[model samples]
Target chain A: MVCIDCSSSSATARLLPMSHQHVALRRFLRGPLNLRPPCCSFPRTFKTLTVHSSASPSPVLAASITSEASAKVIDGKSVAKQIRDEITTEVSRMKDAIGVIPGLAVILVGDRKDSATYVRNKKKSCESVGINSYEVRLPEDSTEQELLKFISDFNDDPSVHGILVQLPLPSHMNEQNILNAVCIEKDVDGFHPLNIGRLAMRGREPTFVPCTPKGCIELLHRYGISIKGKRAVVIGRSNIVGMPAALLLQREDATVSIVHSRTKNPEEFTRQADIIISAVGQPNMVRGSWIKPGAVIIDVGINPVEDPKSPRGYRLVGDVCYEEASKIASAITPVPGGVGPMTIAMLLSNTFISAKRIHNFR
Target chain B: MVCIDCSSSSATARLLPMSHQHVALRRFLRGPLNLRPPCCSFPRTFKTLTVHSSASPSPVLAASITSEASAKVIDGKSVAKQIRDEITTEVSRMKDAIGVIPGLAVILVGDRKDSATYVRNKKKSCESVGINSYEVRLPEDSTEQELLKFISDFNDDPSVHGILVQLPLPSHMNEQNILNAVCIEKDVDGFHPLNIGRLAMRGREPTFVPCTPKGCIELLHRYGISIKGKRAVVIGRSNIVGMPAALLLQREDATVSIVHSRTKNPEEFTRQADIIISAVGQPNMVRGSWIKPGAVIIDVGINPVEDPKSPRGYRLVGDVCYEEASKIASAITPVPGGVGPMTIAMLLSNTFISAKRIHNFR
Candidate 1:
C-alpha cells in the first residue's frame, strides 16, 4: 500500500499570493493554456524522498535536491488477496446457510487470445471464491444479434447474478448497443451508459462503477488516504478509467480536474493535484518533474516498454516513470501489481454485492 | 462587452523556468490549492470596467483599481428574437409545404406564480413561432400516478412534437418518475437521465441539451467566439446548467473545469477562464478580479436583488457583477436580457429540431 506521508513537507505553504495582479495573471496564463511557454518554474524539491518496490527503479536526478528516502510500498496484490479471502468466506457462508451460490455469466464473442485469457481469469476467480461461473464462447464471426441474444439469455437466467461480455467483440458489432443490452442489474463490468450517468449526477447511485477506477479508489481507501477537499487530477479522459475516476473523486468531495488530449499542458494540472490517477496507457508520460511533493500517485497505465534483458523482449511500465516518481511522490503504485489486481477484486466485490442484494441475503 | 486587452502586457513571456525546481514547487501550490494564504497577493486590477445595461449597477469599488472601461453587450433579447423569427419562418414553410406544424405540450403540476408565468411565456413564444401549444394544470396535491397519466397522454399525442413538465413539481410527487414517463422522442426539456448521459459521452449526441447551457453555448457560437483550445470554467454544478455546460464546452474542444459549492476558492478557477458561464444564483458572486481580462462572460444567473429605485422594488442580477465585468470582459451578457431570453429561445430551437428530426424534415 502506498504510504500516506502526512508528516512530509508539502508545497502548500509556499502557495503564491493571488493579490498580486501581475503574478495572478502570470499563473493563469502559465496554467493549461501555455503548455510549452519556454519555462514555467515552480519549486517542488524538498528533502530526500525515495520509494523502493519490486522492479522499482532507483531514484533519478529529478529529486537531486532531496535526500534519498524509500516510499511505503502499496501492496495491491496483498490487499486484493485480502478482499478475495473476504469474498471467499462470505460466499461459503451464503452457500452453506441458504444453498445459494453467487453466479457470474460471461459472453465471449471473439477468439482474441487476450479476451480469452481475461474470461478464463474471471472464471477462475469466481471458482476460487466459490461462485458459479457460466461462459458463452461465440465465434469471431458471430453476429451482433447472436451476442445480444446470449446477453438476453444470461440476463433472464435467475441463477446468474452477474454477467460480463468480454470487450472488443468483432468490429462489426455495435459496441455500445451490445454493452447496453446487458441489463444494468447484471452489468458486472458497469459499462452501461446509465450507470455512468448515475455516477456523474449527485444524489444518484450507480449499481456498479467500472472496475478499474473503483479499484484505484479502493486502494486509496484501504490505505486510509483522505480524498475530501483534496485537489485530485485524473490524467487521460478515457470513459472507462479517467472519467469515472474523476467522478468518483468528486463524489468523495475532492475537487477534481481532468486532463485530456485536448489539454495544452497536462503537467500544469497534475502538479497541483494532491492525488493523481493516470490511465493514459502511455509509458512514463507522467514524469517526476510533473509531481508535487507529498502527492499520492495511482498509475492505471500498463504500457509494454522494450526491455532487451527480459525473455519477452519487453516489459510492462506505467504512465509514471517509477524510477523518478519513487523519489518525489509520497506514495506510488507500481505498474503490474497496482491497479490490475484491484480490478479483479472490485469485480468480485460488485458481484458479491449484486448477489446479496438480489436474494435478500442480509 | 469589455475590450479585448491583447495589448496589455501579458505574464506568459515572464513565466519562470521549469528547470528551477524551487520556483516550480512554489508556483504549483500557489496555482489552485492554496486559495487564501496569509501573504498571497496577485494584482488583478486592470481598470474600472463599468457596464450599464438596462439598470445594471454602476462601477463598484472592486473595479476601482483600474480606469473605467465598458464591455460590449451581448444583446440576448435581439439574439433570441432572431432565433424566434428564424423558427417562425421555418414553421410557416413546413406548414405551407407539408401541412405539418410543430406542437409543444406542457404539464404544470403546481400553482406557483413563477411557474405559471413561465408557462404563459412559453405558450406565447410557441404562438409567435406558429407552433401549436397545449397545457394541462394539475393540483399541487396530485399523486405521482396522476401526473404520470397526464405525461402518458401528452406522450401519445401525435401533434405534440415536444413535451415539457414544469419543474418544482408538487412535493408529494416523485419528480424523476414523472419526468421519465415523458417519451424520449418528445423530451423537449431534455431532463431525462439518458439524454444527460448521451450529452456527457463523447461521440454520442443527446436528443437535446438543457436549455440554459445550450443557450449559453449558442450565444458563444452566434457571437463568433471560438471555444476550441480555450479554457472554460463553469460555476455551479446543477444538472440543468453547470454540469451540462461543462460537458458542452468539452464537446467544443475546450479544456473545461467545473467549480461547485465544494470547490475551494471558486474565484481562482474563474480567474483563468477564457470563457465563463456562471449559473449560481448568487448576485455579484463573480467580481472583476475573478475574471480574466478580455474573457467572454455569459451570466446565466437571474437572482432578484433588492433595489428601491426599480418599479418592482427589486431587480434581476446575474451571478457576475455586470458593472465591473463590463469593464474587464471582452463581452458580457446582462442578467434578465442574457440567459433568460436565451433559455426560451433554445427551448424553441430544441422543439424545432425535434420536429424536424422526427418528420425527416431537412
Candidate 2:
C-alpha cells in the first residue's frame, strides 16, 4: 500500500495495480452502499486480469480509484505551526499598535508528571505564539484557599486575558471549587460549567471550546472535509473528547452517533460511518474491518506501548490499527503527529480569540 | 383508529376489526424494520386482532402494551408541582427559622408577546412556590448600560438567589454582553456561556441547565423511560432547545441523532427512532408518518397559530402534527398541557436548586 504525505499538495493521487484497485474499489463500494447507483452495471467476470501494469495512470483516475486504499495523513503538526504563525502575526500587530499583549496565567496545584508535562507544553506554546505566560507552581500540600487566592488575583489583573488550572489537583482540594473560583471572562480553558453548558446547547457558542475536540474539528476544516450531511461516529463518551467531539460534529450538521463501553455491536455501527473519531484510549482497537473503506479516521488516543525497535524503549499507538486501517481508510491521522500538536495549537488560538474579544480587536 | 390511554390501570384487550388491526400493526412493523425478527419461523400471521373503539382502552391490556413500549410518560406537571410544593415548604420553613427567603429577579427587555407570557408564567410559578419574584420591565429602546446596571445590582444583591433575563432581548442590545453581566452563581436560566460550556464537556456538570430542555429530560426521567441504548432524535438545532435536549439524551446513554433543516429525508431518520423530541417551533412540521408506532413523542414547540374558535383568537400548536402523531405514537405530550407547564416547573425547580446550593442545604 502507498502512503500519501498530506503535507504536500503534489501527493493528491498515486497509482496501483488493477487487481489491487478492483479489490479496494469493491471494499469502498460496500461501505458506502447508499452512495452507489442502484442500477449501475459492472463487469461481472474478471479472469485474474491486470490492467496496464506498465502504463502510468492519470492523477484523476488514481485519485478516484485508489484513494481509499492509501491513507491521506492529516498533517496536524504542520497545520498547528501554520495556525501558531497566524496567531503570532496577529499578536505582534496588536502589540505594535496598541502596546498590549495577551497574557495567560496557568496555576499548577500538584507535581503529577503528566500535569507538569502538559503545563510545560502549554507555556512553550504560549511563548512560540508571542503571548506572555505566567506560571504558578504550588506544592501538592497547598490549601484550596491558596489556589483560590491566586485565581482571585488573576481575575482582577487586567493584563491576564486567560487563566487555566492544570488538572489533577490534590485530593483534598475540590476540583470543581477551584475551577469555579476563576472568573468566567478569564476562564480560557472553557472548563467552567457555564461555558460548557453553552457549548453543549444550540445557538450558543462558548467563549472557548475545550482544546482537544476543537483541534479535531479544526483539522477537518483545514483538510476541507465536508461535515454536513455526513454520518460521524465518535467512539467514547468522555466529556473532554468523545462527547464534545460528537456535539461539535452535530453542530457542523453531521448526523453523529456515539458508542461507549455500554454500546452493543460498536463496530457494526462504526462500519456504517462516513467519518470515525476514536478516542477510547484502547490501542489499535479499531481494526481495518471496523472502518468503512473510504471513511475519514480521526484517532485521538495517545497511548504508549512496548516497541523494542524504538529508541525510547516504547512507542506511541493510537486507538486505530494504523497499518491495517491505512490499507482501507481514505484518510487517517497518525498517533504522534495527529491530534497531539493540534491541541496546543487550539489552546493558543483560544487565547488569541479571548484577547481579541476582550480588547475588541478583529 | 383505536387510541390506548396507557395512563389508566384497568383497560383490557379486545379484538378489533381484522382490517384495522392488520393495517396498524403492519405500519408499525414497516416503520421500524430493524425491530422485526429475522427468521421465517417468527409469527408471519397474527393469531388474533385486538382493537378498542374508545379513546381510553381496557386497562389490563394497556399496562401490558405500555410495558412493551419500554418507557413511561414523564409526567412533568405532577413532578413540577411536587418540586414546587417542596420549595414552598422550605421557603416557609426558612422564613420561620431564619427570617430569610430566597428571591428571584427577572429582567424583561422588550414586549415580545412570547417573552412577556413566559415572564408572567415564571412570576406566577415563583409565587406558587413561595419564592419572591422581582420584575424589571425595561422599555424596548433601553440601552446596554441600562441593562448592565440592573444586572450589576442583581449580582450584588444577597437575597436574589436566581436571575433570569427573558430571551430574544431587543435586537439593539448585545445579547452576549447583557448575559455575561449576570453573576455566574445567580444565573438560574443557565444561558451564560460559562455554564453552557461546562454542561457540554465531560466530568463537569453545570450549575444550572437551560430550563426548557432540562424540563423535557426531567419529564423523561420521571416517566421511567430507559434512555440507555434507545434511538433518540431531537428535531431542531436551536441552542435553547434542540441542542441541549440532544446532549441530555446522550448523557443518559442514548444513541442520539440530531435532525435539522440541513438534514435530508428527516422523516426517514425520525421513523427509525424510539424517542422523538421536536423543538423546531414550526407548527405541525413533524408528520405522523415520521413517528415510529409505539414511540414516545415530546413536543417542545409552543407556536401560536390563528384559531377563530378560541377566546384568545389564537391557539398553541407544537412542532409535531398532534392529531396525526397521537394515533401513531404510543405516548405523547400535548402542546398546551405538555412542555409549556414543564418549562415553568423546571424554572421553579432550578430556583429551589439554586437556593439549596447557595445555602448548602443538602
Candidate 3:
C-alpha cells in the first residue's frame, strides 16, 4: 500500500495503517446507505495521500482513496462505462415494462467540428443507453424559420423526451429565439431562459439542470466530499458553467463566491476556498499559489496546448495548472478525464429524470 | 456640516478639511441627480466629524446632511415616491396614447393581517401610479385548483400586465402549484419557477425581479453606492429576500456571499463585507460588531417585537440592532423608512415594465 504524502516533494508518499472500523463504515455507506452508485461499486481500502510543495515542506492532505494497494484507477473511461451500463439496464427495464424508450433529438446547424464531435458523442451515448436518437443536421445557410420549424416539430412529438440544439449556431441565427422555440419540457440542456431563471432564484428548482455543473456536483457526492458550510469559489461567470456551479454549491450549503472578469484579485478569493471550480477556458489560469492547500479542484476548461511528442502535436490542458496544483490540492480532476465525462453522465441522468417525470415512473 | 462618528463611544475626532469642490460634487450626486426630490433637499454640508473605536480606529464617512444637521439619511420613502410618480406619468401616457392602463391582478387567500396590509399597500400604490388594480380575496379554505383557476383567469386577461398572489396561502394549497399557474409574462412578483430560475442562472435576466431586492438595488443606485468590486454579505437565504439580494449584488459586480442558517461563524463573513444586507427577520440578530466601520447596511427585516411604550404594545424592529449599527455603519436604512416603501414602488415599476413589454413600447 502506498500513501502519497502531499507535504513531500515526491509525486507519491508512504502508506499508513488502515483502520478496519472506518473501512467497514465507509463500505456500508457506499453500499446500502446510497440508493445508487451513479457509476460503479465502492472499493475498499484506497490510499489516502497528501502532496507537499518542495518550497513549503509542509504536507497538504489530499483526498483519501480506497483500495490503495491493488485498486484499479477510477478513470473517466471506466466510470463512464459503468454509468452507461447502469443506464442501459434501467432503460431496458422501462422499455420492457412500459413499452417506452427515452428519445433525444439533436439539431446541429453549420458544421463546426467541435459541435459535431459533441453531437456525435451525445448520439453515441444515447445509443449505449438504449435511448432512441434523432439527428437533424442543417446547412450553414439555413434560415431562422427553418430551424424554428424543426424545433416546433420536435416540441409536438411525444416520443421525443429531450431536445438539444448544438451551441454556437451560425452567427446570423438568433440563439435565443432558436433555444426558446424548444418546449420547456424537452429542454434537456436547461439553457432555456425560464430554466436558467428558475435555477438562479431561490425556493425554486428547474425541471432540468445545466449538464456540466450538475456533473461537477455529482462527482463531489460520489467522492463523499463534505460541502456544507464550506467556502466554494467558482471562477468565471459564463451562463453554462461558473454561474450554475456557484448556485449548485450554494444549494448544497456552501458559502459560495463567484469570481468573474470584473472581480479584482480573484486569486485572493480563490485562496480562501475549500473547493475551487474554474471554467474560464484559460490554459493554466489557476496556478498552485492561488489554491488553498488541501482544496478540491474541479477544472472545466478543455484547452489544447502544443505537445510535440503527440501525433496531433497538441495535448488537452485544464484551466488549472495541473502539475503544480496536484502538489497542493487535496484532490484535483485532470482535464480530459475530469468534468468532460461527467457531462454526458449528467445528460443521461437528466433524460432519465425527465422520462420518470413524464411517465410517472418510480 | 456635522458628521456623527459612530465608531467611537466618545464621538469626538478632528474633522478632515473638505474642499468646496468635493462638497459640491457630493451635493449634486445626492440631490439633483435624483430626477425628482422625494421630499426636501438639505444643505450641501452640515458637519464633518469622525468616530474612533479601539478595535479599528478608521472612521465612517458621511455624505449628505438633512436640515437637522444629521448625516444624510437614505430616504426610501421619498425615493419610492419619486419612482411611483415616474410610473404614474408613464401609465398615464400609455393610457392616453395606447388606450391601455397597466393592470395588476392580486390574489389574496385567508386573512393574514400582514398579507392584508401588504395587499392594501400594493393596491394603493397601483392607484397612485395610475395603474388599474384587480383584487381577489379568497376564503381560507380555498383549494389549490380554485387558486390555480384564478391565476389562469389573470393569465388570460389582456388588461392585466402583472399577477401577484400574496404569499403564505393556507397550508392546504400547494404553493408551488399555485405559483406555477401564473404565466411567466404576467408574473410580476417574479415568484414563478421559470422567473425564479432565470434570476438564479447566469447570462439570463428575469423579466421581472422580485420586488424587495429590486428595490434595494434601486435605492443603492439612487443613493450612488458603488457596488462594483465591493464585498457584500447577505444574511438569510429566503427566496424572496436573501437569495434575490445576493443575485442582485452579483449583477452589480459585487463579490457576494450568502450566510444562512447553516453558516458557521456568520459574523466572520459579515465583518469582512463592505455592504451588509440583512433580511433574516430575526429581531436585532446582527449586532454592531458584525458590521465593518464603513459598511452600508440595508436592513430588510420589519419584525414587530414587544415594546409596551405605545397603545399597540408592540414596536417595529429590524433584523439589525439598528441603534448600535447606525453608530458603526457608514450608511443605514431605517427599518420603517428603508425597504418597506421601496417594495410598493418596485411593484409599481414592475407593473409598468410588464405593460411596456406587452405593448412593445420604447
Chain A TM-score from candidate 1: 0.82
Per-model interface RMSD values are: 8.8, 10.4, 5.9
Q: How would you encode candidate 2's per-residue C-alpha lDDT over A257-353 as one tens digit per residue?
A: 7776655546645665778987766556675556665779998876555545558655666767676567667788887899879878888888888
Chain B TM-score, model 2, reads: 0.77
- For model 2 the local lDDT of residue A165 reads 87
Model 3: DockQ score: 0.31
DockQ: which candidate is best?
3
Model 1, runs deviating above 4 Å: A1-70, B1-65
Docking class of 3: acceptable
Q: Each candidate's root-mean-square deviation in Å?
A: 12.0, 13.8, 13.0
Q: Arrange candidates by TM-score, descending.
A: 1, 3, 2
> Candidate 1's residue-wise lDDT over B37-144, tens digit each?
111122434544453221111112132325555678898999999999999999999888878999999888768776787789899999999999999998988888
Off by over 4 Å in 2: A1-68, A84-165, A177-188, A201-205, A308-313, A351-362, B1-102, B107-120, B136-160, B305-315, B357-362
